[model samples]
Target: MVTRDSAWPGGVPCWVDLGVDDLDRARAFYGELLGWEAPPGSPETGGYSICLKNGRAVAGIGPKQGPPDVPPAWTTYLSVADADETARKISAAGGKLLVEPGDVMDAGRLAIAADPGGAVFGIWQSRAHTGIGLANEPGALCWNENMSRDYEANLAFYRSVFGYDYDDMSANGFRYSVFKVDGNPAGGIGELGADFPADIPPHWMAYFAVADTDAAVAKVTELGGGVLRTPWDTPYGRMAILGDSQGAVFAVIAMPAGG
Candidate 1:
């Protein structure tokens, strides 16, 4: 398990948050499923709730801030040394900024951007909030991955902006790679082939570690969430995709022994 008291290194995926219409329902659904304790959002921060696990910050749940048609979804935030500089790089690398770099009440400076492949993510330059406090443990964020329809363009975009090196793991008909920072695996990028539904746009997916994948799947269904994929074992672990009652998608995984 990984724990941190300070900001994550630049280029690492440091946090994941969900923006939904029903803050209370989202809080309850995740609190029950992942053993999180989320206090009511305060007006000062525009009703943003920071979900905690074992008394440490794990993720955030907040009211949706975009257009009315945009669906509720989880967003992955990558740590950076300078949010403004990263925003510049994003534009230079064929990305579009949805939100310009700005401070969020001194918690951090942030910018929301979409890669050429249309995968949206956040760039964070932390201040008081240093991102997730715990990870790779049950109920904590274990992984984040970007699935891209235009793989090559997105790959170039990230490499240029974040200096990420990839450890390709493609085999058979699959095209996948792990993005690394200083030789350590940070996240993943996978090519969304023709088999993927055309309507599903490129997006980053966040994975939460669980003690038992099947149990987590059952709990999700019992909590009024729907399973998008059944639990399946891989060399890494058993995992499944799920959608919350608000239609926010995320994944849960039971990591292999000593993994």
Candidate 2:
């Protein structure tokens, strides 16, 4: 199990949260599926629900504040030493700034941005809230990946903005790269497969750690959520893609011991 007691390093994926249409339903579904207990959110923080596992912060669920047409999705947030400086670098690297750097009360400062390939993500400068308290453990985040049509362009944007180093893992016609921070896996980038519909834009997908992939997928189905892919084994672990009851997509994996 990987546990954290302090802020993450710059450019590391330190947090993730779902922006859902119905906060109550999201809380219920995730609470049942991931064994999380969400305490009452303080109004001072806009009623954002923080999901906790074993008394530690795991993730968040909040009401979607985007346009009415926007669908619920998970946003991956990377840690930064300076939110304002990272926002500037995002613009200079050909990305569009969605929300300017702003403080979330005294919790931290954040900004939303999209890569040139249209993958939206967030940058966080931690203050009182230092992001996820437990990760790489059951019911917590394990991996985050971005799928884009123009993989090279998006790769260049991230490298330019964060000075990220990647380990190319492309093989057998599949283009994939794992970005690392200080020798630890930060996230992944891959070219959207040919099977992906053209209308689907580039996006980031978060993966939660589970003790049993097949069992988790079963629970997802039993809860009225559909499984996008049956559990399958990969070199890294066993994984399955799935969508929540509201169609918010995510993945779950059971990593090999110590992997």
- Each candidate structure's TM-score, on Cα atoms with residue i matched to residue i, is 0.98, 0.97
Model 2 lDDT tens row, 178-255: 998888778999998787778777999999999999999999998889998899999889999999999899999999
- lDDT tens readout by residue for model 1, 33-138: 9999999878987789999999999999998988998999999999999999999999999999999999998799999999998999999999999999999999
Lowest lDDT block of 10, candidate 2: 38-47
The Cα local distance difference test for each model comes to 0.94, 0.91
How many clashes in each structure?
0, 0
TM-score of 2: 0.97
Which 10 consecutive positions of candidate 1 have the poorest summed lDDT? 192-201
In candidate 2, which residue ranges exceed 4 Å CA deviation?
none
Query: Which candidate's TM-score is highest?
Result: 1
